[model samples]
Target: MGRIGNIINRKGKQDAKRASVFTKHARAITVAAKEGGADPEYNAALKTTIDKAKADNMPNDNIKRAIDKGAGAGGGEDYFSNTYEGYGPGGVAVIVETLTDNKNRTAGNIRYYFDKNGGNLGTTGCVGFMFDRKGQILIAAENVSEEQLMDDALEAGADDIITEEDGFEVVTAPEDFNAVRDALVEKGYEFVSADIKLIPQTTTVLDNEGQVKAMEKLIDLLEDDDDVQNVYHNWEITE
Candidate 1:
């Protein structure tokens, strides 16, 4: 199959990925609620954080129970979020964000994956400069005009907004995420997902083989680790 054909077929893999991604995000929400306030009304970040979870089909009971558990005694100690910087195959900068209580175990496994997969695990701040943390909001594209979308997003404190073929990517500061999400929600926008994400400052172009193989290896290593919450890389991909 050609590259585009392979990408078309990979839609199934994305569905599989959702299951793993939701599990990781669930842990993140539990941790966030524990550290901050459990009440989503008071904790704006946690509110949007859980919103993304629910957007992905996470059960309402699980969401409510996570908040209760997060506020309960002895909950925060089981999870902590951290970001690891590294260089992947072809010198691609990769950042792995994780929520794990056992930092030692997570670190050891991550380092091993990098070493074994033609990558190098760098020290803190090594490749971190390659990325910037931002608020990312995605809303359904149906019947939404770019001009109206831009106006609404900017009014909601978004730094910039781009309308994609399938949806809109609204960008904002880490602090402004909740406000943007709330504004969009009140406007009756149908959002697929809304959360804080890290965007690569720059991206590296890769061949089709490089893209598939590198992602396959990275995904395999990541899904095996219970501590990994999210992984971000600068490898530029296309259909």
Candidate 2:
């Protein structure tokens, strides 16, 4: 490929990434508003989703349109959430959470991705039991003292803190997420990301190159789907 080809590939990837982010965020805002009503003050889920969208630098106009759509003023598209469980390469348990207006189409795409990527989509609760739901937050490891972080996180009701070379990950009970986050904010700590996540109980390490590649492709396919909100797997592999 020539230089022009590389440029086109990069642009295409960028466009796809942007479109994926926009679709996911818009659908999140719409669904959150619909479920809890359009008023953020009265709807904690909507408020949090909207804040996440804004954090990703989503346009206010787009957010407003989604709110209107959810309020039945525009778009008229109805969306619902779905989850798919499966085993990926190396028998790694995988979970895909989706927001879709067309369940049939979303199901088909998810099945196809799993099948083509050397995996099989399975029934609900198949892989779900191997995970635990927790509120997780991450902060960059730099410019912060470990002692201070440990003190603040523990005082803020975090259940545990895992320090890595790249970042500090704080885990909290689901019900304590907001309280913990607010306490950290008061201590002037900024988060890289904060979310309720399904943490795996165990992990499969894939040393085979083929298995690693297949797992990576499988994740990319699931995440690239317009309806997918999140994808989780217990594969400890590097690309």
* Count of clashes, each model: 0, 0
- Estimate the TM-score of every prediction: 0.85, 0.89
TM-score, prediction 2: 0.89
For candidate 2, lDDT tens digit of each residue in 1-239?
43223323433664558867888989999999888999998987887788777756689999999999988888588888999999997899999999999999999999999999889999999999999999887777668888899999998899999876566889999888877877887889877667788989888889988888898899888878889998888875432
Cα deviation in Å at residue 189, candidate 1? Answer: 1.8
lDDT of 1 by residue, 97-121 (tens): 8888789989999988888877888
Poorly placed runs, candidate 1 (over 4 Å): 1-19, 73-77, 208-211
| Per-model CA lDDT versus the true structure | 0.77, 0.84
Question: Which candidate's lDDT is highest?
Answer: 2
- For model 1 the TM-score comes to 0.85
Cα lDDT for residue 93, candidate 1: 87
